[model samples]
Structures are given as structure tokens and as C-alpha cells.
Target: MTHRTLFLTGAAIALVATAGLGFGLGRLTDKTPAAAEGHAEEADHEENFIALSVADAAKAGVLTTTVGRGGGSELVLPGRVALAVNALAALGAPVSGAVERVHVAVGDHVSAGAAIASLRGAEGANARASVDVAAAGARAAAAAAARDRRLFEAGVVARQDWEASQAAADKAQAELRAARAQVTAQGTPSAGGLATLRAPIAGIITRVDVRVGAFLTQGGLVAEIADQSAVEYVFDAPPASVGAIKVGDEVLVQRPDGGEDSARIVAVAPSAVDAGAAVVRAKPTAPAPRIGSIVSARVILAKGAGGLTVPADAVQTLEGRAVVFVVEPKGFRATPVITGRAAEGAVEILKGLNGGETIAGKGAFRLKAELGKGEAGHED
Candidate 1:
């Protein structure tokens, strides 16, 4: 064969080989199983079933409760336990002085008239001197008045002079009475011009601003006492929530420690505060939390027509929808729900649930986390 003919044969052979290689690659791609198997695994993960044995569930604190009927929606607002305005007593220095002694520390229970501190100052000295001088002047005026009466009766002095002496005696006696009142209001005085600071009302001392030997200016805070017995829960409710809450509605105060107390709405401000929130006050039905405790306040706006309800904690948010895990024989299934008003520590389920169904209560979040883990594992 000629050289040109040989070259054509070689080129035709090369083209055939390339076509065969392309066909082989297509067959191999169709046989691969990884992508199909991965998709199947993801479909299974989306089911989100959490399986736990009875013992395991108990260990995980997975609690369940039956659905019931309830009414009302709770408007949970942030609040704090504070001393009632009428029950707060702030003790300040009646006059500038150096604190000579401190008899009590913060948290000390004190009764009315109990001595809290002692202060030595020139003001106390001046207050005492005024009382002594007034008393001496009163005595002299009384003696003069008596002599004037005798002189007028015996005709030894003119009637006008006797009358003038009697009027002066009356004015001096008035000054003495006023000075004595001033001494009583200034509190008990001791030696070295020290004035004892006394509690004006029975309460627990919540603050102490003065220490032994601390110099306090006039009107400076010495201590603060609060009567916890009449404590109030104060809430700053958002403007949108203020309209839902009204006086006489019941409120639930939740402590930071997960404890709860009952309260009744006593007052709602007509306008918002500087923070653009309305101030609400509630009186606790049970013993109040310690003063200055920040807490959660849930106010019941209104009780709607009776409907199916579950424990508030039973509901969890999943995939942007509220869901409750319905307990099954082998595992719990997350069921989406349409919820309505919530009240009395319970939530109203408007749809996706029927009465008498057992559902996860307090520890439902564990199941949600477990489901999330499964999805994340499949994604990897």
C-alpha cells in the first residue's frame, strides 16, 4: 500500500478508539450508586423520629401530659419585684454629721424606733442649746406674770403695766413649747452632740450608705429599708401589649429559679414611661420574691371560649412552625400545630391535635435537638 493510504487507515482507527472510550465512560457513570444512596438517606432523615426506651426517656427528663381545655392568652412581659412605694423608707442624714457608730448592716430586720446609727455634729449641739435657753426664758416669764397679777390686784402697779407683763409671759411660754417640739423631732441626743438615727418603720434594711466614721452631708442617704410583706411586681409592658392587659386581670410572676407566683393586676399607667413602655403593678397572692429580683411576668389578657390546651412548655418551634411531640409506642413524632390564645401556664391548640392525646411536656426540646442532629448527620 502507498504511504498516503496507510495514513488514512491509521486516522480512521484513532477516531474509532476515541468513540469507544466515550461510550465506556457513559456506561460507568450510570452504574455509580453514591448520589442515589445519599438522596435516599436524606429523605429518611427528614422524617425526624426520636426513639427512646422508657428508662432513657426518664433519664432525659422527657415528660408527657394529656391535652385539656383552657381559655385566655398570656402576654408575658419582663418585670421585677420591687418594694412598694408606700412600703419603702429611705433614711437620710437630718443634718450633716460624721457617723460615729453603725448599729446594723444590710439585711438586718429592724422595728420602728430601733436605733440604726449615731452621728456627732454641731447641728445637734445647737438644737440642744435652743431647748435649754427656751426653758429658762419660760421660767422667768412665768415668775414675772405671777408678780404682775399680785401688783394689779393690790393697786401697786398701773393696770396697763400689769397687762403688758402678762402678755409678755404668754409670748415666752409659746416660744418654749415650739422649742420643745423641735427637740422631739430632731431625734434622741447623746453625749458629745451625737444624734441617734432611728427606724421610722418596721422593715428589712436593703441598703446601707453610711459606715462607721463616714461623713454625711445634709440629706445624704444613710440607709434604705423595705417592707417585703407588701412588695409589688412592677412590669414595663410594651405599648402593643398594654391594651390587652387591664386592671383586675390575673398575672403570673416567674422567678429566675423557675418558680412561679400568682398576682393580680392592681394598676396600669395611663401613659408610657421614658422607655416608651407602660408601667404595670401587680399584687402577688403568694409570698413575693425578694426585692430587686428581676422576673418574668405573664398577664392574662382575656379568657376566650373554652378550647383544647396543653402545658405551655409542651409546644416547641420547628421549621418556623409550632410543634408538639406526640408520644408513640416506639418513639415520639413531631406534629405541627396551629396555636391560639395561651393562659394559666397552658397553650391552646386550635388545630393538628385532638383531646386525650399524650404529648411531650417539659423536656420536649430534647427531641427537637435529637432530630436536628439526625438531619445534620445525613447532610454530612
Candidate 2:
């Protein structure tokens, strides 16, 4: 062959080889069946995550909640929300010391006996020691009082002597009682002198005033907590209407915010004076309305009902099944759930939920309508 012909033939061979190599690599890199299935699953998961910002959620009127077991029996009455006696607590330092840590923040839920903050108690050790000392003194005083009583009864001591001894014992007892109060007011300290401030009752932290490393004085406010669920509805029942109102009646509470909850009559007291309106106190079965909110309360007379429930509006029907839009980190997820009886503007949940899930309330319908747009309105 000539030189030009030879060069052209070699170039054609190289081009064909390059094409074959590219085809082979493309085949190898193509996704396998299993890999393709996995990709679909991931896409599905991403699709399930609804993307809504906090502000949008607020504008949509989405109210979140942790599901709680509730009483479904019902009644209707007008009432105002009020904190239960002892439901509100303004916790202060157990003893004068610098704050070591604040364990909770505003809007956090806390259980009874759970620690909310910790501080080094300057008088912790001394307080414990004082309790020990007082206890010994109390024991000694009791023993002496017993001895004097026996002597007086036996006619072996003057009446005045016995009386004086009794008085001395009383004085000692008072001193001991005072000393013990000091210890109790300041919780027992850890070996390292840390005094943990615990919630007096299960509640929500409404305020936090202590900062880490800040010196707190004894009795200085550290935080404030209110048992959101530990509230009672006070209704003024007319004397004629009061006869029908009785304890143990169920109440469905409607708040101004368009949220609903249930409570049960715990007390019904007539006015101390003549013809005054009777007072009816109902303890809430679910988390309560904010203190001081005027609410419409429905009292149900029946019994044999109890289950996990949320606001009736919170439950929505989609695709022929009941679903609630549960709040998620990114947005809301429509979770299929089994529901029971409906009463008092609320519905019972039989399955498909554990407690402590934040869910959409008032604005639930908006979510359902938005979600009804299917994969079109909500995109991954």
C-alpha cells in the first residue's frame, strides 16, 4: 500500500476501537434493578417530606400538639380557663450559688420531679448537716418529754416540774421543725454540692431567668413553669341550672383559638351565701387552653369512654381513610390513623400513633387540601 492509504486505514481502526470502548463503559455504569428500586424508595421518602417553612405554617394556622389520652364523654357549659391550685410555679434557687447549667428552655415540656436546672448550693452541705442535728435534738426532746410524763403520772415529780419539762420539749420540737424546713426548701445537694432544681409538677416552662455561671441568690427566681394540662374550667352555673350539674360530668372545651380539649367535673360547689351562682370546676383530661382564655365547655353525662384524641378538625379523610397531618422537621406528613368515637369537638385515636407527636390542628384541613393536589402540589 502507499503511505497515504496506510495512514487513513490506521485512523479508521482507532476510531472504531474508541466507539466500542465507550459502549462497554456505558453498559457497565447503567443502574442495576436493585439500584433502581432503591432510588425509587428514596424518591418516595423525599416526596413524603412536605416542605413548609415556619412562617408559612403559622400563616396556614397550623397548631401543633402532642397526642394525649382523653375522656370522650361530654357536656356543654360556658367557662374560663384557670390554672389549678398549685399548677403554677416560679422556681427559685435552692440555695445561693452560681448556676451550673440550665437544662430547659421556654416552651419545653417537663415532667414532675424532672430536673430543670442545676446550681452549686453554697449551703447544701450545711443544710444537710442541720437536718441531722435537728433530728437528734428532736429525738432527745421526745425522750425527755416521755420521762417527765411518766414521772408526773407516778406522782414522783411536782406538777410544775412536769409542766416545765413539757414546755421545754415543745420548744425543742419547734426548733427542729424550723431546721428541717431549711433543708427541704433547699433540695438535697449532690456530693459535689450541686442542687438540681426540679419541676414541682409536670408542666411547660414558660420562662427561664437563670444563665450558666450566673450567681443566683437564695429564693431568686430561676424559672417559671405552668402545668398546661393541670388546669380547671370554672363555670358559673345558675342556681336552677346547678342542680343538674354534678361532679364527674365530662366537658368539651372550645378555645378562642379554635382548638378543642376535654375535661371532667371534679368539683361543684354552691355559693356560701344565698342565691349566688354556683361554681363548677372541671379538670382537663387533655392539655389545657392558655390560662385566662374564655372557652365554651360542653359537659357530657355518659361514661365508658377513654382514648387518645386530638381536635376533631385535626383528623381528615383522604383516599378513603382517616389521616392526620403530623408535623415533621421539614413540614407535615399525612399519617394514616385509626379513629374511634367522636365527641366534644374531638376524636379518639385507636391506632397508628404513639403519644408525643406534634400534629396539625386548626389548619389541618388546609394541609389536607394542599396534599390532595397529589404529587403535583407537593414535590420532592
For model 1, how does the per-residue alpha-carbon lDDT over 28-134 read when each residue is reduced to its tens digit? Answer: 78744888788676556547577665457768998877888776556677899888878989998877789999989999999988998888888777877887888
Clashing pairs in 1: none
TM-score attained by model 1: 0.55
Can you write out model 2's per-residue Cα lDDT over 122-238, one digit (the tens) per residue?
598777777678778878877888898899999998888888878878888898888778767787775456778889878899999989989988889998999866677898765
Query: Worst 10-residue stretch by lDDT in candidate 2?
Result: 42-51
* Top TM-score model: 1
